[model samples]
Target chain A: MNETLAGWLQILALVGALALSFRPLGDYLAHVLTCPRHWRVERLVYRVGGVRGDADQPWPAYLRGLLAFSAVSVLFLYAFQRLQNHLLLSVGTKPVAPDLAFNTAASFVTNTNWQSYSGESAMGHLVQMAGLAVQNFVSAAVGIAVVAALIRGFTRKKTDRVGNFWVDLTRIVLRVLLPISFVMAIVLVAGGTIQNFHGIQSITTIAGDHQSITGGPVASQEAIKELGTNGGGFYNANSTHPFENPNPFTNWLEIYLLLVIGFSLPRTFGRMVGDNRQGYAIVAVMGLVWAASVAIVTANELHSVSSSAGHAAGGMMEGKEQRFGIWASALFAVSTTLTSCGAVNSFHDSYTPGGGGMTIFNMMLGEIAPGGTGSGLYGILILAIVTVFVAGLMVGRTPEYLGKKLGAREMKFASLYILTTPGLVLVGAGLAMALPGERAAMLNSGQHGFSEVLYAFTSAANNNGSAFAGLSANTAWYNTALGLVMILGRFLPMVFVLALSGSLARQQPVPVTAGTLPTHRPQFVGLLTGVLLIVVGLTYFPALALGPLAEGLR
Target chain B: MAGSLTRLLRHHLAALRMLLVFTVITGIAYPLVVTGIAQAVFPHQANGSLVKDGGGPVASSLIGQRFNLPSQKGQPSGSPDPKWFQPRPSAAGPAGYDPKSSGASNLGPNNAGLVKAVRDRRTAVAAFDRVPPSSVPPDALTASGSGLDPDISPAYAYEQVNRVAKARSLDPAAVRKLVAEHVQGRTLGFLGQGRVNVIVLNHDLAALKRR
Candidate 1:
C-alpha cells in the first residue's frame, strides 16, 4: 500500500475509534460523576481518609481540597526524589538535585510530565513507579474532578455547592483510570514493553561488544502515561525508544489512549447538561481544529519543505524512527501537542519549520482542541462562554449559555482563564531570550534557536510536556522557570475555572427566550472555532513570527 | 484568624491522609500487580526481550546495535565493518547507540550543524557502500529518534547488500535474497513503514557466514 494511503487510513481508524467510544465512554463518565452511591472500595478509601463522600462542598471548599492535595503531593514526590538513593529499588542511581527534585515534583503534580532529568540514568525504579507514576493517576483524576465540578455548576441552579472533591477524585482513579491502565499495561508488555525490577543488565553482543540495558516497571507507567495524558518517558527518548514503543501497533495504541478520554469528554458534558447536541457542537469544533493541525503537520513532513537538513537527507528522517517513518511520527506529534500529552515519537526540533511551528501553535491554542484528559472539555467550555459573550455584544442582547447567564463575574473568570497561559509563555520566553546565559543553552543558532526557547515556554505554560530537546533544558534557570510556569499554568486556570463554576452555580438559570443564543447549533460551533483560532492566533502571532515563521520563510 | 488557621491545618491533614492511602493503592499495589502479571505471562518481554547465543545473552532484538570494527585509540567513531549491514547514524551518547542515554541529536531541521552532519553522513555512507550519494536512502543519512533504534528502512538495508557480499566473499545474489527475506512490511498492511530489524538481521547474517 502507498504510504500516503496508509496515513489516511490510520487517521480514519483513529477518528473511527474515537467516534465509536465517544457516546458510551462519555455517558459512563457522566454516570460516574453524578451517581450517588459510592463503590465499596471508594467507601473504604473515604473512611480511611475521614472524608465524607456524600457531603457536597461550595466552590471555595472544593478549591481548597484540590490545592491541599496538590501541595501535599508535590512535597511527598519531592521528598521521594531527594531520598531515592536510600529507597528500595534505588538500583545504583543517586538522589536527584534540589532544583531538579523541586521541578520534577511540581511538573508531575501539575500534570505537566515535563522532565529535566534523563530517566535511565537519573531515576531509580522506586521513584519512577511510586512517585512519578502515582501522580500520573491522581493529577489526571484531579483534572476530570474539576471538570465534573464545573459540569455540576451548569446543572445546578440557585446553589453555591458544586460537588464533593474527594468523592470525584477517588471514583475517577479507582473506577476509570486504574482499570483501563491495568489492561493496557499488560497489552503493552505483550507488545515487548519491559516490565520488571531488574536494574541495569550487562550483556554481550553478537559481535564482541558489551551493552548495558536498563530495566524497570515500564509497561505499567507507559499505560497511564498515555492514558492519563501524562507523557513523561521512563527513558529520555520517550515514545521513540524501541522498548517503550516496540512496534507501530504499540505506537498507534498509545496515541489512541492519549486521545480517547479527551475527545469523548464533550459527550460527558452534553449528557450531564441534558443537551447531547451541545456536546456534539463543541466536539465538532475540537475535531475541526485537531484535523486541521494534523493535515498541516503531515503535509509539511511528507514534503520536507522549509528544512535544509530534510532536503539534504532527501526526506525528514532525522530524529525519526525507521519503523514509524514520517507519517506516524507527524500524527503522534500533532496529537501529543494538541492534547497536553507531550510524548514524542520523533524530535520536534528536527521537524520542518512549518511542522514544528504547528506543534508549538497547537500548545499556544491552550491544548483545547480535544486537549488534555479533563482540561480539554473545560477549556473549550470556557471558550464557548466567551463565544456567546462576543455574540451577545454584537447583537445587543444578554448572553445565556446552557441556561447560565454570562455576567460580569463569569466573563472576568473566563477572560483570565484565556489570558493566563499566553501571558506566562511570552514573559517566560522573553526572559530567556534576554539573558545571555540562557541563550547559550540553545543548540541551534538564529531563528530556530529562538523557536527552542519559545517552544519550551509554550509547552510548559500549556502543561504540554514535549520539548524542542535541543534547548539543553536541564539547566538551573530552565528547571526553576519552567517548573514555575507549569505550576502557575496548571493551577491558576483552575482557580478561575472553579470560581466561575461557583458563580454559575449561584445563579437562577435564565429562561429561554427569542433573544437567547442557541449554543447547540452549527452557527455557534463555527463562531466558537473562529473565536478559538482568532483569539489564540492573534495573541501569539508576534512570537511565532519572530521564531518558526522567520526560519520557515527563509 | 486562629480558627481559620486551625481549619487550614485540618484540611491539610485530610490531604496528607488521603495521599498516603491512595499511594498505597496506586503507587505500590498497582505497579506490583502489573509486574506480577507481566512477569508471569510475558517473562521474556518483561525482562527486556534479550536474545541469546548458546546459553549467554547476546543482544536484545529490539535495541539497535552498532556494527563497526574495534576503535583505534583517539578515534571518535569506529570504522564500519563492511561484512555487516550498518545501522543509521545515532546521536545517543558521547558515542551513538548507547541505550543508557537514549536520545536524538535534537538539532533543528535548519541548523547549520545538522545540515553539515547530513552532508557528511551521505558522503560517508555512499563511500562505504560504493554507491552514489543520491542512491543512499534518507534513513542512511539521518539519525534515528532513539539513537538506540534497532531497525533501518528496507531501502537502506538493501543498499548495503553488495558491500557486505563483496567483503564477505559471498554470492551477491544470495546476499540480496537475505536482505529481501529480512524486509518486514507494515503491520497489518497499513500501520507503519517497511523496515529490517538491524539486530535480528545481523544476528542471522552471522549465522549465514558460519554456513
Candidate 2:
C-alpha cells in the first residue's frame, strides 16, 4: 500500500507535467501540419524533390492520392525488406525468413509491430532503421492525416475536398513529429539510453565476472516508438531493457511520451475543426474513459498479485521489475493497453485472474482510449456518431454530431470500420480454440489459457500488437493468421474511413439548431460512453466470458 | 451528369497521384533513411544484438540461454547442479524453459493439484538450501508465465546462497553479498518488485571460482 501510494504520486506528477507541456507542443504540431509557413529547410526539401506544395485537391482527389501513396508505400517497404538481407550482407546479416518478413511488413504497415522474431538477431541495422523505424513515423503520420481529414469532413460546408494528403503528411512528419522526436531522443540519450553503433561490450560484473552489454542507437527509434504509440523495442524485453529505459526517470519519461501526443491530438482536432469545445469534449470523454479503465485495471492487478492465495507471503512481486514497483508497472500495463503501444515492463500473464481480465477487456474494446494516433480519435468518433444515432432513435429525431447529420452512408462506414476487428478477433479465437493443433499449443487449459490466445488475436487484429506472449504464436499457422489479421484490421477500417470522409465531404454541413443534440454536455458524454461499451460488449461479450471472466471464477 | 462525374473523377485522379507520391516518399523513403542512419551510427546494435562465442557470432542479446540441466539420461533420481542458479519453474515439457512450447501451468491456488505441486517444490528447495521450507521464496516454487524468465527474486537468490557457496567451497557471506549486489530494485522505487539475474550471478560465481 505504501509503495502503491508513492507510485500514484509519481504517475500523477508525470501526468501533470505532460499536461502542461501538451498545449505548446499541440499548437506547434497543428501549425506544422496545417499552417503554411515555409522555413528555409522546407524550401530546400521541396526543391530537391521537385515537389510543389501548391496543389489543393478536392475530397475525392485527396482520397485517391492517399490510396496511391499507401499502395506505393506498401510496394517500396516490401521490396526494401525483401532486398535488405542481400543489401545489408556487408553488415553480416542474411535476408529475413520469408514468413517473418511478411509478418514484419504487415505489422509495420498497419502500425502493429507484433514481433514474433527477436529484433536484434533477425534484423540488420539498415532494415531496422529504414524499413521498421521509418514506418513507425509514417504509419503514425498517416493516422494523423486521416484524423485531420475526418475533422475537415465535420467542419467543412459545401466543400468537396477535405485537404491535400501530401501536404498533410509532409506537415505531420517535418513540422510536428520530427522536432518532438529530436528533443525526446536527446533527452532519452541524456538519461543513459544508448545512442551509438559500437559493438556489444563485455564488461566485468560488479561481482568480478564478464557479461556482454548490448548497445545500439536506441534513443532515436525509442522516441518515435513511444510518441507514435508503436511498442516494438530494440531488445526483445522492450522497455524492460536497462539501456533502453535505464532508470525510473527514463521509465516516467517513456510513459509521458506515450501519452502526451495522444492527449494533445484531441485539442489539435478542436483547433482544426474551429471548435475548441468540441475538442475539449472529445478529450473529456477520452480522458474519463481512460482514467476509469486504468484505475480498474491497476487496482485489479495490484490486488490480485497481493492476495496471491496467501501461499506467497510477500506482496505481488513475481515477474516484475523491482525498480518500478507494482503501481508503476500496473499503471504502465493499463497505459500500454489503453494506447496501441505494447511496450511492457511487467508480464501481464503473471497478473491475477481479475487483473488479466481487465487487460483483455481493454484490448477487446479496441484500445480506443486515446488509441494509436489518428486511429484512436477516429475510432472514438465512430462511437460518438453511434451514440448520437441511438439518442436520435430514442427521441425520434435525426441524429447529428459536430454539425454533421448522422446519415445512412456515415452510419454504414462507421459500423463497418468499428465491426471489422472484433469479427476478425472473435472468429480467429474461435478457430484457434476449436482446432486441436492450436489447443495443443496451450500450456494451461480452460479459462486462463483460453484468455492468452484470445488476447493475442485481439491485440494483433486491432493493430494494438501487445500480446500475452505465452501463446506459441511464432508458428507458421499463427504467423500467417495473425499477420493477415493485422493487415485487414488496420487497412480495412482505414479504407472505409477514407471512403466515409469522401462521402461526408460531398455533403453540406448541417447547421446546429434547436433540435440538435449537444454532444459536449454531460448527458451526451454518458450516452457516448454507453454506446462505446455496448458496441464492444455486444461484439466481444461471449469471447470475454470464455476467456478472462471464466478464468477469474476458476 | 456523366460529364460532371468524369470531371470529378479526373480531379480526384490528380489528387490521388499526389497522395501516392507523398505516401511513397514518406512511408518508404523516410524509413530507409532512418534505418541507414541507425545502422551507420550503431552497427553492433543495428545487427540483431547478437552475443557471440569467444571466436565469433552465436546467440542473441535478447534470448535466454539454458542452464541447470540434469546430469543423467531419463533418470529422475538426481538433484540439479547447486553451482548453477535455476530459472523460475516452467511447465513447458519434459524439461522446462522450452522455447518451442512456452507457457505457464494455469493452476488455481485452491486446487488440490496446485497445493501438492507447491508442497513438492517447497520440499525440494528446503533440501537444496538446507533451510526450513517456509523460508523459501514463493517466486522460487511458482512457475513464471513466460517460463523463460532470466531473473529470480532476490529472496530466492539469497535462499540458495548457502548451497551454492558450499558446493563451490566459497565463503557463504561473500556469496550472499554478491546476490544482494545483483538485485535490481523496483522501477522508480515503486513500479515492480526487486529481482536478481540468476544467469549473470551464476556466471559471476563461475568466474570467481576460476579466479
In terms of TM-score, which candidate is strongest? 1
What DockQ, between 0 and 1, does each candidate earn? 0.86, 0.15
Residue range A170-240, candidate 1, lDDT tens digits: 99999999999999999999999999999888887777667788799999999999999999999999999
Tens-digit lDDT track for model 1 on B53-108?
99988899999887878766755357788988998889888768889999999899
Where is model 2 chain A poorest over a 10-residue stretch in terms of lDDT? A202-211
What value of lDDT does candidate 1 attain over all alpha carbons? 0.92
Task: Classify candidate 1 by CAPRI docking class.
Answer: high
Whose DockQ is greatest here?
Answer: 1
Off by over 4 Å in 2: A43-52, A89-92, A198-213, A305-319, B1-124, B138-211
Q: What is the Å distance of residue A210 in model 1 from its true position? A: 1.5
Per-residue CA lDDT of model 2 for A1-554, tens digit only, reads: 35566667776787688679767766766666577567776565555444455765676566666655555555566676677767642144567666777787788777888887766556666566656777788778888888888877777767777777767776777777766776777666665566655444544332222335554557777888898888887665567655566556778888888877778887787787776777777778778877887788677755653234424533444444444556777777787887888777666766766666777777777777778888888888878888888999998998888777778998999889888998899899889988999877765566767888988898898787777765767777888888899988887887777777777777777878898988777787788878888888988888888877766665
TM-score of chain B of 1: 0.94
Worst 10 residues of 2 chain B by lDDT: B57-66
